[model samples]
Target: MAEKKQWHETLHDQFGQYFAVDNVLYHENTDHQDLIIFENAAFGRVMALDGVVQTTERDEFIYHEMMTHVPLLAHGHAKHVLIIGGGDGAMLREVTRHKNVESITMVEIDAGVVSFCRQYLPNHNAGSYDDPRFKLVIDDGVNFVNQTSQTFDVIISDCTDPIGPGESLFTSAFYEGCKRCLNPGGIFVAQNGVCFLQQEEAIDSHRKLSHYF
Candidate 1:
């Protein structure tokens, strides 16, 4: 019999979790970060980037629904949406559920992340990528926000924790750039890390975002 492989989550220094890899689906070092997808008994298919778990097929709906829907609902009649760094397409899936949303532009830093996730984790995206209103831009989220002339009613930052390629997304300058891309009365929502482990990150983000919003 073969030995089981284990994947350890590297999100926290003091405490962490591990997954039993039932199978290795895909693994690669993309231009931006290290990406890995594997099967687990509990989580179904798991995608991790830079040693941190991004999403799992089992519980993805919980995170994706909250991150994409709450602000869109609050904004009321949001027709255009911008998603930054959701290469997995799970955010895209939830946003597309809104029949009134006429357009969705997802800015992802790594093309490989999107491609691999589409191949290995179809359930996450659920063909939302093929929607006529969906546009996939292969670019850094910060640069996209800064350069785009178009404005959106809701901007969703589905970025990873502030590290590696995602570090710039949490900066004050990036927040300011996103502000520039929002329509008047626009709502911006982001995935800050777990509050218990990343309290300082939440505080810093609040301090920076306060300058713009």
Candidate 2:
């Protein structure tokens, strides 16, 4: 029998599936969770959180574009934007694409993730972090949303799965805080994973958001 490759992903474990890896590029354990960046022959660079695949360089544009554009385009003339948990900055890159967006403030609990992505997965960020209009706040997204008096035309919470440090972003209180920070008629977008894989989280998020927004 051939030796099996190690797949470091909780989702795979949870679903009883497996992930094939071409190479493991970087790995580390943060105070929060384990971070791993690797390459697959098909996916290029892949970033995983606590062993779960978060973003892959190959299909990231599709995700970031849809997540950032739909709400902003529909809202139509947003100036200020607030992003929570997008420590990788891909969402920030897409948000700045709108010429009407004059400012962007991103709140991320893990600064180390930002630095890691900046250095290794540079393609995701596209220089957005260095943009003068973009401001990166290294703090808990939940607290920032609840505490910031500044209102925004759009709020995008590009968070990880609803577990570990990201669990708070999925709650009713967080939704209320997001609503509190929104300008009149402003919109909020959150990337909830596929319902088939995260049924409870998806339904629960919808329920909480409906209650607040």
Candidate 3:
């Protein structure tokens, strides 16, 4: 006779049946709104505050579009792009919008986040994971900035909130590293810290960035 399956495994399988599909209503971290995922999930949002913040099966385009286009347009003729901490590949999707782009690199500290985004947030990023132009480096953004000899035409910051693992990305030292990674005329655009919870920190970052540029 076949051995009986473990009771723990049976219980775990049963628990999965209780899961309720839901969407993200909204997520406002101390630094920014990380994202609202899922249709009926807790923070999933269909129509947000502006009514313009509409939802789809995917949630990455909004963040990617805003972060990439603004800087690309402002700088003009982006040939190469680097993304710091945008593990979800949202920024990658938007960076590819430039036909002039020659290469794109993203340094995200967490490989798991990239995997999750690819699996769960397909619509948000529009399957950017499969794009050939994207090169994902599962390394610390700070480290990548210091080591990379090649410069970028645009550097978009796609870091997490400051409260957790992403704290250092907002520091002056990281900004210095960012300055080093830029080509002569490259534009560096980051989240700039948060305007609300970290207002003072944001001011300080702005001051630091001004000093660099």
RMSD of each: 0.9, 1.9, 10.8
lDDT of each: 0.94, 0.87, 0.65
Candidate 3 deviant stretches above 4 angstroms: 1-62
Top-scoring candidate (TM-score) = 1
Error of 2 at 133 (Å): 0.2
Where does model 1 exceed 4 Å of error? none
lDDT of 2 by residue, 1-213 (tens): 666466756674445534677788788987687888888777889998876788989999999999989999999999999999888779999998898899999999988799898888888998988898988898888899999889999999998888788888998888999999999999999989889878888888888888787
Candidate 2 residue 26 C-alpha distance from true site, Å: 1.6
Pitting candidate 2 against candidate 3, the one with the higher TM-score is 2
Distance from true location, Cα of 189 in model 3, Å: 0.5
Highest-scoring model, lDDT: 1
Clashing pairs in 1: none
Error of 2 at 165 (Å): 0.6
- Which 10 consecutive positions of candidate 3 have the poorest summed lDDT? 5-14
Model 3, span 1-213: residue lDDT tens: 553321111112224212123434333321222332334343232322111122333454556688889989988888888998765555777777787888888887766556655665565567766778778888878888888897888998777545455777887778888899898888998875437645777887788888788
For all predicted structures, in order, the TM-scores are: 0.98, 0.94, 0.73
Report the lDDT tens digits of candidate 1 across residue range 64-150.
Answer: 899988999999999999999998888999999999999999999899999999999999899999999999999988888899999
